[model samples]
Target: MKAPPHFIRNNEEWIIWLLEAEFSGSATPHALSSRTGISLDTIHDNFLYMERVGLLSIERDPDKRYPEEIARVNLTENSLRVYDELKIRPDPGDLF
Candidate 1:
């Protein structure tokens, strides 16, 4: 599905869309960064912002490395609602 024209167009939209469409609502920040070509730090920053806004829930694992400490990231109901509304899906040909 394509994002509606009125949908908030930003990196975070792509992040949440990826989570909903491909990852079953949960994935590592590192994997997301790899998939989206967004930096790990940027993904972490977005996660924090999304969490604060009640869009995402982040789980940290100290057993992992620095950024990987953010072991898992999941979309919240609010985010899922947005995804359902926007229906944004990146073209598979556009991804690595």
Candidate 2:
């Protein structure tokens, strides 16, 4: 599906749209950073902000070894609804 005009207004929204379209239930800030070339700090901050705005949820990764702190991010139901409304989908040409 094609994303509607103004569906993604900025990099942060693009990241959220990407999460909703491609990652959904299994995403991490580090992984998103790797995928989108956005900085980890920016990803983390956006995750937190999105969570606050009820667009996504952040949870501690339970499978992490030792004391490393990592988060698993998931799009909330509201975010899924927004994605559906926007007809957002990953661009095959951009997948890597």
Candidate 3:
């Protein structure tokens, strides 16, 4: 399968890591970078991009956990809906 777009890969990685972290009860950028080997800067930059595209939600609330969180990435519902519109599956794969 063709690799996901470089940007998309980064964004997806971020979302995956963010949810993983949240579920694992750890939501720190440092932890994410350490887990995914995606640099902190890249993660943060792509996060803002994802946020703009509405694929990620970055909210700030005084009562919210991690109130000063730098990011809160996830696959927005719209993103999943868009995926259906552009769906393509790999034929089959084994490294040539």
Candidate 4:
């Protein structure tokens, strides 16, 4: 497995980890924000970042104009390989 890059943010990694078990590897930004106690904007940013890096595939209507409108965030095939190489798990603190 390829090693996860140091540039990957904790929240980004957490989002990927959560996606693995969410609706068969897909979920909406709102769902992820609610589950992680993170802000929707933050989730959107992470999603975009992952998407830019080829680690995620976002499903949305062609007319959708905002990241928040994303219908589903699916893990890319490469995501699992990177996840396996992740050496750190994000600390959820008391959010759990």
Q: Candidates' TM-scores?
A: 0.77, 0.67, 0.49, 0.71
Give the poorly placed runs of model 1, Cα more than 4 Å off: 1-8, 63-66, 88-96
Encode model 3's per-residue lDDT on 1-96: one tens digit a residue. 123323333455445434433444225555555666766677777667766877666544455343235644445666555444334422234223
Candidate 2, residues 1-96, lDDT tens digits: the string is 334235456665676677866775568777777787777767777777787899887787677732224467787788777767557555445566
Q: How far is candidate 1 from the true structure (C-alpha RMSD, Å)?
A: 6.7
Residue pairs with backbone atoms closer than 3 Å in model 2 (clashes): none
Query: How do the residues 1-73 of candidate 4 rate in per-residue lDDT, one tens digit apiece?
Result: 1333344467878777667744578887777888888887777888888899999998987777776478788
Question: Which one wins by lDDT: 3 or 4?
Answer: 4
Regions of model 4 farther than 4 Å from truth: 1-9, 87-96
Candidate closest to the true structure, highest TM-score: 1
Number of the candidate with higher TM-score, 1 or 3: 1
Between the candidate structures 1 and 2, which one is better when assessed by TM-score? 1
C-alpha RMSD between model 2 and the true structure: 7.3
C-alpha local distance difference test of each model: 0.81, 0.68, 0.51, 0.74
Model 2 misses residue 49 by how many Å? 0.6
Model 1 residue 11 CA deviation in Å: 1.2
Question: What TM-score, to 2 decimals, does candidate 3 have?
Answer: 0.49
Top-scoring candidate (lDDT): 1
Which rank order by lDDT, best down to worst?
1, 4, 2, 3
